[model samples]
Target chain A: MTTSKPTVFIVDDDASVLKAVARLLRSAGFKNALFSSAQQFLDEHDSNASGCLVLDVAMPKMNGLALQQTLAAQNSELPIIFLTGNGDIPMSVRAIKQGAVDFLTKPVNDSDLISAIQNAIETNQTTRQARSKLHELQQRLATLTPREREVLSHVVSGKKNKQIALELGTVEKTIKVHRAHLMAKLQVRSLAELVKMSERLGIISSPLE
Target chain B: MNWITIVWPMMAASILTLALLHLVVWFKQRQQVAHLFFAIAALGVAVMSGMELIVMRSVSIPQVVLLMRWLHLPLLVVWIAIICYVRYYFNAGRLWLAWTACYLRIFALILSFTTGQNLFFSEITHLKQVAIFGGETISIAQGVLNPWYIVGPLSMVALVVFVVDASITLWHQGSDTARRRAIIFGCIAFFLLASVGHGVLVHTGLIHSPYLVSISFMPTLFAMSYELSYDVLHSAKLAERLQISIIKREQAELDMQTQRNALTHLSRVTLLGELSGSLAHELNQPLAAILSNAQAAQRFLAQENINLDEVRDILQDIVDEDKRAADIIQRLRLILKKADCQLQLLNVNEVVQDVLKLVRSDLKNRGVTVNSNLSNNIPVVTGDNVLIQQVLLNLMMNACDAVADAVSIEQRQIHIHTRWNGTAVQVAISDQGTGIVSDDIERVFEPFFTTKPQGMGLGLAICRTIIHSHKGQLWAENNNECGASFYFTLPAYSGETI
Candidate 1:
């Protein structure tokens, strides 16, 4: 898929503050989306959208932390930066514990909000990149036939071809051919790369045990 | 050396002593007119006793008759004095009755001097020696009885009727002191009757004895003196009790003042805790906008291709937001500042609006929608503005809490109304929460009485105190439909209109 430019999503109940923050973000050369409420944001949320959410923690319904919980349940990769008018310690601590990028109090300094947004956007990018890479790897793993997949699991578990052939009740030549074909399909240039790929796919467990 | 000579003089001296003591009392406290009348009566009685002694000792009929005629003057003085004393001391009597009695006695006195040799005799035929007080000899007059002698007894009967009538009026007044006074007056009437009856029996020749009317008059004087002295003693005790009660009332006022100050302080603290969150949000909104708008303006200015129009808009927004934040701070300062109560003429509707503005966000957060019906015709009221606002804030806050857990949006409504009720401006706050527990309706305004798990319970109590100090009233009642309504009234300003 073609990657789009990351957009900062800002959700705040306060209209003037929301407009002002959006203006600041625009001035700072950031693409931004605005939602006046958590429900509005939730309604318009896109899983595939790559960005960080700057959320006010004291909204009337579905406060920032509660939205964070909802997003977490949905396995969303959107990083959150909490903004509260008066942030208490326990609340800030809880927000940070629940995977919020930062908890900022309002009348937030421009540099602080900008930096927190930048940090959250970077976290979102890193998580999305990792997810996509895992998706690509899973696609590559799906290309192997059943016999090649069995051979790859045994080979990555540090099994020699003769021991693998004995366990599979197959000839050593057949086991070698299956391993070579699976390695080519997985695009590994060396045995170390093959073993690393097996570890990434969680196929290194000894099937005989 | 008859014992009558010594005893009559002794009785005269003792009655004179009593008169002198009361005269001194009347002189010191000139307001004691009753004491003055008692002194006059005692002195008259004393003079009568002296005259009686001379009559009893006279050896000739002419001497005895002359003394008897002069004795009527003292008798008339005593009768008038007793009438005046009873009238003044008891503070009750028929005025016409008293005047008639006095006039009748005066008529008898005139009759004694003009109608005959004396009121008791048309003529004294001879002087007779009589034995009295165990056979000591004293002279008595024997004569043809004056038909007008009946006037003397008639006057005494009138005096008795006057005293009895005054006593009955006093008895019907139904106070402990008045009843006691009535009893004393009854005694005076009985003594007067006995003296009159004795005088009549002796003068009518029904018994042979020296004229002892002066001695008989002594008991009536003694009864008058006892009543006067009892009054003096009772008044002194009353003055003492008045002093003690005055001191006690002053102490109680001081204690109330101290409690009021403490409650004011406590209420401020409680208000701060309750409003801090809303205040932070209130202040932060404008501050956040101001900061962001300013920074955005800076960014726009620093750019090579700066948009001056946008920058101007940003600066304008910044100024507006700054003013908004300042306004919030000013309102908060007004609420939290500790100051002596300074009363000023205030518009009730304005006070309601100010408090509603302060708690707008808080009520919104609790999902309570306030409906205000403020009457424009409300007259201005004199009150401490901040204190009145505090009262409104407290009531509104309670209204918010009342509806916080309501099952429906309709039940989360609060209605505040203000209007002039002729003499005073009244404000009522009604909520759609479940009505207060019928028993807790009044108790809710008592200090430290709360239904909320975390409530300090001083809100309603403090509100009431503030209202009372403003010469207003605050109370709560369950609404007919669904909730409790709190009502308070502030008297319209009666001073010069501002």
Candidate 2:
């Protein structure tokens, strides 16, 4: 994951704006991939790749908002940064609520744009890291027996071996074996590490954490 | 009774001549009043001649004269009809309207009936022998005039007044020189002279015998006929001249308006030329999008796992965007198209919007905010669309420049409002910029006059010209305190009445 190079994708309906922004991004020390429309970007998009998207809010056919919904439906984690020429308040609020990384008004200052792009890239990296961890956790879970799977869920829920035994109607010694085997197979050395992994994978959100 | 030999031929000739004159008027003009007068006169003469012959054959002299006196009633009725006919021929029926002359004819008929008892007519000497040119002796006694005789003169005076009133009406209505003086007025003069001859000669003691007045009738009647035909021909010529003058007036007004609009448009075109880079930028987006979409479609088709449906949609989008780019280009080109100026009709909103597009970036650069409220259902107005757009662009550009000059970014606002006027559309483009002084307002639309250092001053003048070409009006007025509002109006698609 660390070996992959990062790029900022720009999508705009206006060519002059597209060219101007593309030039600005290049000047700001960013590798930029350009698309004129959301559809065009989607057609050539590699959802698995880690990158930040710069999408214009107003566009023909498929706008930036619709593209966001499409990406969400596909569960793609490429963080989006919205760019709008006519930036109204309602649209900004709506975009931010829809999980947009940032909304920047056009003819934006160079420092402001670079900062937004950096934040988006960092967010995308975090999302990809979390998704990959989930994949790894799922792979580990596939090795578990039905009984072990049940014991694993209870154990993660702050259940002691004795509580697990009482809940599952099993002996303490048997519960101990299941816990030891689950911990080893899950590759978790501590309960805190396991909870953190689960939280990051979106399996659960602990109030205490 | 030599009455048949003496009176019948002459009565027949008079009646036939009256009928022929009426036929000429009717056939030439297709006028209805002439037909009416002809029927009444011809019938009156025929009936009176028949009664005279019948009375002479069967009745004694005194009784015959008594009965013959009543024949004057029908003849009086015919004479009154001639006055009405002549009045109508000159288009005078509506002066008093209400068919007042016909009512007067009825009064004359009733008076004619009462005239026998009243001695509306009487023989001065019962047995006077008068010599005839053909070596024949005839009892040609002159008839005495009575109170009923006053009706004929009174009717003539009223008729002459009716004609004089028409002439005055035409004068007040401002007819042309020839119509006011020569034809229409002359017609009244001729009619008054003849009417007075028949009306007042005997009562005023100007003539002893009616034969003296009778001699004037044939010549005057023919003269009146010729004068009326002349009036018709003259009216036709006057109407033609009026129609031409109206067109010329309109054209002159249009030319003046066009001059103003063209000046304004020229200024706008110059301003737009300066913002050509921004315009290119606006157009380039769709062009680039079209290219990118085309490239994407080509790549998808070339690939083994080509999504045909997606590619087709992409191609459709490419085409659509391409057309969009082309349309923008076309609209921009319209401003630049070395077009020969033409005038026609247009939806004002469409023209306004197109012109706005031409200068939108300049407005943005100047930080001027423009708000437009154009009624959707405004009637199609007649004007030159290109020139109209040119006018709007000029005005808007001027507003933007004025805003820049004032250096008030927050108040650099323009409002365009339109609504349907009853017979016109009122359009106002107001700007909150530095106001033009009261003294300068009137001179703003003059050709080659500009207050701005860079301005050609032709802007407002050209706006005026274009507005005038559309048969509209344009002017500049100061806002409440700080700005100027350019107001204009266009005539709606209503029709003209005759």
Candidate 3:
């Protein structure tokens, strides 16, 4: 199978491992960076980034698994591929403890690295996409006026403008004005666009979505 | 000339000696004082009665003079004891029964206005004056068993009952109650003996006169008189002086104790002053968190009308945080409540946690690492929690301070352990810092000794006090290679085998 460049974050204290992993990823056409230690990885939490971690199982200051802990603490969804030079069952047990993407030994098989990276990159991309959609919806909702937002609830309920006006105890003209403003603020040109906005933003998921 | 003529004066002397003994006992309720006085009084009654039987003689003016002199207060002293001992022994702390006795005394005094003639009628009647055994001649001032005399002795009995009853209550309330049982039995025995002695003089006509028969008991009276007058009086005087010396000593001890207590409290206050920052920070965090959370909810509420469920959740959070704030305040107040450690059943784990919190920042500042491997399931033990905390804190702090001049940061490590040993909870607080020499462990609990340049040497001593208060054991020992460990054990009481 044809594989694209897979993004991985390599965290370790040994300068050679950090450099070698970064070079290996570069050689394999993988987008990667070298974080000297776990503390540095913690300081650089990027839920917006599309990547996974290639961590050293045991490092001087902070081991690979401990960095995984730091990532978990920040509530990031980036996948992790634990790569320890000196591997053991206990280290593997710890790596798999927190839903790691994959556990691999140092000088990992190029194919295994590529496949795991592809999987992690794909997962991270999906997370980013979902987050962007939610952000867009939140921004759109933020633009709507207090009154227009109230009317917009009724509009989503498939109520006609006149019916919405009657239900809200307001004039039909006022209902029309509110609906237009709501449509404009939500950046939806039509009713179909509005339903698609609700679906895409996960405001309301369709039963068959 | 017979035993009857000699009886009045000797009885009066016996009563006088007894009254004096009672006075000393009343002032100084020391065991030696009381035992000496009472034994003297009982012996006096026994001896004077015996002497009257043995020696029959005439009434000298001096004898009448002595009888007249001692007439006033000895009976009164008996009544006083009846009231005082009864009140004390019963722990009644009430004066009504005693007050009634007082009034009855007044009534008896009022009735004595008619002269003792109505009480004891004196007659020089002719009778057989036999020098041989078995024949009796007597002129006697016979007592009528008048209601007044009966009132006094009966009231005295009532007082004994009051004391016995009080002791019974004490027996029920106290744990080691054999002492109370002994007291009650002793009083009961004496009461029976006195009643019989009084009966023999009144009804049996043992010597053909009340006064003469009493004279027959003179030898026994003197033996008792010697015990009472000299032994009780002298020993009681000695006991009184000893008691006064004891009181002075106790007073001095109490004064010194109060001073030491004041100093300790002052030192603690100074210690708290040093801990003011940590205390303030500890107090302020929850308060600040409470304020921020409240404001966040308020902002959320103000931005738009909040949902009922969301509002309810916010309110619940506010209530929970308020309780947290209140708990911080309560804990702070409790810590500052002036070292009054009341004894109760406490979980050892709590003491460990509390000491850690109190000294956490201090240890951090000193770069000392404390690892607590507390047994969460340690059983609740009977002890003073704060005092145990104090003991733990002292050891930890001493460890921390001891390593101040040491080389490595790793050396300043403190480890705490809690364990259940079937019948007791054992807590071991160990520190890998400076270790005490083997010679010093035995004398460490002694007062006014120190290895440290600035220490008062009272901390470990006081720790022993607290441990003993809980019926627990505290000792220190060096670990296998290095460091020192302090282990204390608290007993699980009354079938608590955890």
Candidate 4:
């Protein structure tokens, strides 16, 4: 997908700064998305896209910090890197506290900004990956029948079919049938894979051990 | 009466006319009490002289006695009025002595009516005709003097003492007017004593003539009038002198204020001149940007696969950044322009940005990094835009100079901060460099004080003056770690609108 190449969304009120920064990123082989204001970025941004935001701190209407808060409120995984012409210690501290990837002053060094953008994009991808994994596991868990889910949970806890059937007040053959269905639903081939999948889903912190 | 005897009455008439003229002057300026008293004394002398003429023409003892008795009336007034004249004019006298002389004259008047013919003489032995100049003859009374008649002479003697005492006191007090009064009244007293001696001798028949007391008083009266007129002229001269001196003092203060303003303006102009080179480089920044963008667009257009989108953006930035550089030059020109001080409401942040724009190229060239921490929502400040811009430029350029000497490029930093503190907006520029020497911190604002080579040293001094004229304050202090921080404040304009 085009998403494999990370996009840097830049929002700055100064057209010259926006142009210069876009040119720098384009030369550095980075995909650039330019917006003139924070509101513009919010209005047009694709929430499902995995990328990082490069925002100017002193924009009119809505500033970088305010945008950081809005994105945070929405549980957006988009990492934000702040750029400002007049950066102070307190402002950088506040931005960092709000989970900003980096706070840089204007006329920023190209390598510094590029590395920070790279770091932010990597973090966004890592967070999205983990979220999608959990989502996939939840989807699989949702498809299982109630009896099959109960049978699967006991089996993944290192219980044998005999032990699971005894706990369910059922025969071993009936427990075996429910386990087969749940394994197929979860798409796991072996007991070890089933345990590993359950662990990935955060159904348990660890297998029976 | 002989024509010579008529001389005394004519003299009395002239003296009366002179005194009346002075009385008219006194009426116009009633504040001079001495004039009023001098006129009264002169009138008394004139009337007494007339009475003496009447007594001299009497052909019998009863007639002479009657005329002499009435003559005591003016005699009483003459002594009392002259004493009052001395007191008011010189403002110096023994009150009791003057009162005693007056009371004795009053007693003499009482005896003249009560004892009748025994008033100034116990009895008149005979009346004799004395022939004089012009073949005119006048009657002279030969009388046995009453012992009690000594009262009149004694009072005259006391009157002389009062005049002498007042004159001496005036002399000892020692001012120009006092000395003049002393001399004037002193001569009057001398003439008065001689006049009285002549009158006494004539009354006792020791000399064959009429009493000439009134004529004797004329010189003293003239001197008193002259002194009073001199006092009026002296005060008028003094008033004129004071008026001239006050005008001169005000002019001198105005000149000093104007000079101070000129010095402040000159210092600002000189600072702009010194920063001209850096300011040129500042303009070059945007020009270089525009050139690079245009060249890059030309290269893009020539390519077989032309990137029109990138080329379009490049051309647009060139135009915009060129305007940015033009804006910087415009701000620099504004400060350097010669103009009168015009105060207005200004946003301090905008002023700060203008200063930074002019100095940006200089900072980059010198490897100095600047960080600004301007607070949002600062209120408008009241100041002259050009003058305030000059102050900001001076501080920023000074900051760049301060950071140039640091050990490393990374250590060379200038921080510009601003905040709104309720009543005023404050701007602080701090640098990380060699800090100011402890003793030189306060002296930095003094004219002609400098640590840098080739520095005129009026920069900080002018900055302080401009801020002070705006009813603000500017100061500098060394930072704990390194370098120094300079701060200034401008009062917030509180009007509803600019």
Candidate 5:
């Protein structure tokens, strides 16, 4: 897939690392955003932006993990890649569990850092697209009537028109009309598309399954 | 009778001999002013006694009067000398009282010489031979006492007042010798006063006896000599105690100093252990940068269009990074030096900066901001370079540790200041964390005294030891705003390089 220049947001309290990492990423043809502290990064944070955070695990005021949590809370799809001077298993485990892309220890290999940033940026783009698709599905779902919403849930759950009718205590002809209106509102054609839309809006189970 | 005559003369001679012996001691040690005065008083008593003995043997009234006229001279000398002895030995006595006694005795002496007849006896009735002690023929006087004879008693009263006042003062003020002085001087003075009264009454025929003032003074003289001997024994004992204590004090100080050296070494080792992680990170930074720059340079060189300026900048950074790495190691090596402390002239600010370089990584890791206000005119101090660096390292590391758990990064600040303070140069390190409690400020410098759970508690103690060894002082105080400040002062370099 073709991609534009991906920015690597490098946040470290150490001036040397901030400058060094920024330069390294720059030389590798990646756009760089540098911040001395996590707070400064948070101040200029773009929640909608798709990039990778090459953040120092240990920083003054707010650390990498804390920033990761804040971004996660705000539902930002920006992937974080942690860089630490000393890597403790528990800290890395926590950062990864909080949706961080990767955890690397300094003096990180240039190749490894570049790959992690690549992976993170790729992941961020995928996540951003998925989030936007889910948002579209939610907006479409919001337009459906109560009867149509029930009919859509039954349809995504592998129910036939007659079974949905029986479950909703409606006639099969009435269930068919409600299904058509919901599908049109969701802008989907095949049952597969309708099922996928329902999954994205979390009408049934997770989309991964 | 024979025993009495021999005892009286023998006692008089013994007092004179004791005084002369003490005079020899006083001559040997001129600081013993009291001994010399005692000798003079004793000699005067001996002279008066000898003349009194002659007056007792006189055959005619005129001959008795002739001896009596000379008697006041020795009496006056004895009185003056005794006052001086009391003043010096007891370290007491009012100056005015002493002067009054001396001047009155002098006036009495002059009156005795200038008067037409004897100062004590205006008319001598006859020389009545009496059978005195030891079957000695002593000529008793039958005379009408001169009204001016009251001068003798009055002078005696003044001498009595002076001695009594001195003894009382010594009793109140003297620490070790008060009791002894009060008893010895008080008893001797009272005895002398009674002797003077009895001698006067006997000479005027109120009692039928020869003049016995000399004999009376003999017992008191023996008592005074005994007191003097006791004083010698007491002082010798005191001198021995003083010498022993001085030696013991010196030995204790030496042991403390030795312990300090060992503890300082131990603390340095401990500090190295603590900083080892940050040191690795510090070294890794430069190493990583240098590697990256070299790679970058090689990549540029391989390119068709070579970027010479970029490659030059990259190579320059690598060189600088190499030096930075080497500088860290050099600082470490100097601090870890295992040798006896050597004194050298060092800029206080330079020492502090060197230490800060060593701990820069650690401070960054802990998110502590260090603010150093090194004065431009900071004077050089004479100290062991490595030891001073270690002191600063320990102090700065301690300050960093102190503020590690502060609520905010802004609160986690360590401030270092160095300035010239006239006679000395001072360095102060302050932290904005939990300040040392008032009671623990001094105790912080005691070995094995620690506030940290993981601390071996020898950092401050070792710092203090190192500073003290350099003839400097180290102390800690709580800051008004927050946390604690540790200060050390080193003597300024005085052109005398060690």
Candidate 6:
């Protein structure tokens, strides 16, 4: 998580379109990158770059939808905004369903493209933040001992120390000690906060009857 | 003058008139050999009538014999003419039979000249004056009949058989003119046989009568004249009908041409409709660029510290994009305009490149690539520019559709080739799609024939008509390995100032 200005990565097979979109983004005081084709974007793009993708839907090979699928397979968090010269209803619907932030037709209005880019960048930022937070939580969860991990699950499931100890064949004193250690390792002070952290990490199920 | 003198000369004069009439007809239309043969036959008949008149007035055996001796010459001429006339007019009859009849008649003429007083008599005993036509006198020869006289009757028999055979064949041909001609020939045959039978009876003295062979042939001449006159009248009517049909056909052709032009315009509009999205994209690229550049320049202008150099670059780009958009519009207008055929000298390669530019984006969108091999030194062709462009555009669009579903990128290529082959400029467009169905190759150019589900089937038909009107030819053939190729040739302008 480096703090930097988000770049709008624009991919279009048409050089003029790519240049025009890049110019518009630059005029809007946003940093931007340009790729002439989907293959070029795939080959040259920086996966670690903090950005939203502005893609042309009708590219020669590996079109916008295919690129979207590829990035999704790679777990890339870059939000996509589609720009197509001829956007039909079914195509726009498919793009939207595939998690595109916006499907705009060309000659796109400057305001609409800029707003779409802004929304896409905002989404990317939120998604990136949540993903980093989850990563940090997983790192912290990995440091817990097996007994402490079991106790954390029982605590998150709304189990009492006595019930946890009964399930684990331990005394209430040992269960309580494990709960404190796991909560401290997870950096949560209150029981509710601990449960929330466990849930974030997907540590265990909630309490049943 | 008595009846024999008046009537015989009148017969000669009438027969000579028919001969002159046919001679003039043959002179005007030399291809009518039948007319020429009929003229000769009538002339011989006229001469025979004159000789019979001389023989009928003869008072001595030597005079009658001498007159009868040369009369075989006219008879030989008549027989030859009849054989040739029947062959030419009816266009039937056995060749061997006709030749036999001619040779036999010639043998009789040679015998009459060489060995006998005449073909019918070896020697005349006396010249007998007979009063038969109400006190008019004519001569009858009492003679020992020439043993070879049977040759003349035998020849007549052969001529009659030949004519009857020809008439029957002509009748079997089953046409109006042929049936009429056959009936006329049948009457001539009967008259010829009757005259020959009468000549045989008179020569053998079976009946007491002056020789009337020349008079007996008059009916045959009349029948022939009737047939020939019928032909002349029928042909005149046919010529009139032919002229009317020709005018009607030209009118139909003009109407067809007008309809075709309308259809061509309609199809061009339909093609534009199909390509509207691509053309919009084409125009939109420049427009989008211009908008973006202008907006970007506006933003720069709005800045407190304006970047003059950046603004200048954006303005330049805007101008370039505007020109690009204008070019696309100009092309669209050229294609969309409806006009008549205006032939002018055009560089084929330039038109090809222009059409390729128009369809470039559409083809790219469909993932089809076009490769061109154009000869630099090819001669200019004469044609309507927009129509030629339409042909090229239609073919390229069809090629794009052909390769739309190709499995491989390599198979999605269209090749356009142009060359100058001495007299004409030839252009060939080939595609690596599924080659046309073998049976459909020729039918592809026929109107309303199509293989595509959404096709109007007039594209190739119109293309062929356009090419043909330019004095060019269009054809299609499947490539040896795969795909199909369409070829067209435009005649090269010969530098004639028109």
TM-score of chain B of 3: 0.48
Ranking the candidates on TM-score from highest down gives 6, 5, 1, 4, 2, 3
- Candidate 2: interface RMSD equals 10.6
lDDT, candidate 1, A1-209, per-residue tens: 32788889999988899999999998898899999998999898666788889998876646688799999998887888888787789989999999888888888898999988888888888888887887888899999999898888788778899999999998999998888888888998888998877766777743454
Q: Give lDDT tens digits, candidate 5, residues A1-209.
A: 12455667888877765766776676676887888887888888654556888888766557777788887887777788888877689988898888887998877887888889898888878876777777777888899888787788788889889988887787999988887788788888999988876766778897567
Tell me which of candidates 2 and 5 scores higher on DockQ. 5
Superposed Cα deviation of residue A60, candidate 3 (Å): 19
Top candidate when judged by lDDT against the true structure = 6
Off by over 4 Å in 4: A1-209, B1-150, B165-181, B194-221, B235-262, B278-390, B404-427, B465-472, B480-482, B489-498
Off by over 4 Å in 6: A162-174, A205-209, B1-259, B344-347, B371-382, B406-413, B417-426, B480-482, B490-498
DockQ of 6: 0.39
Clashing pairs in 5: B1-B134, B2-B134
Model 5 chain B weakest lDDT span, ten residues long:
B1-10
**How high is the lDDT of residue B197 in model 1?**
83
Candidate with best TM-score: 6
TM-score of each: 0.57, 0.43, 0.40, 0.48, 0.58, 0.62
lDDT of each model, Cα atoms only? 0.85, 0.67, 0.60, 0.81, 0.80, 0.87
Model 1 has fnat of: 0.70
TM-score of chain B of 5: 0.52
* Global lDDT of model 5: 0.80
Weakest 10 consecutive residues, lDDT, candidate 1 chain B? B360-369
Question: What is the per-residue lDDT of model 1 for residues B1-498, given as tens digits with 9 covering 90 to 100?
Answer: 767788889999999999999999999999888889989988988888888888878887878778878888888888888888877777778888888888888888898889779889999887777676687877777889988988888888888888899989989999998898788878878877888888888776677676677787788788888877887898899999999999999999988887787778669768767877887778878988998999998898889999999888888888888898889889888878777788898999999998888887777556577899999999889988898998888888888888989867788889999988887899999998888998888899898998889988888888898999888999999999889899999998888643
Off by over 4 Å in 1: A162-166, A169-173, A205-209, B1-269, B337-353, B360-388, B396-439, B450-457, B465-498
Tell me which of candidates 5 and 6 scores higher on TM-score. Answer: 6
Off by over 4 Å in 3: A1-44, A47-209, B1-246, B307-311, B339-341, B360-369, B376-380, B400-413, B421-424, B434-458, B468-471, B494-498
State the displacement of the C-alpha of residue B489, model 4, in Å, after optimal TM-score superposition.
4.7
Q: Candidate 3: deviation at residue B368, Å?
A: 5.1
Q: List, residue by residue over A143-178, the lDDT tens digit for candidate 4.
A: 999999888789888898899889999999999888
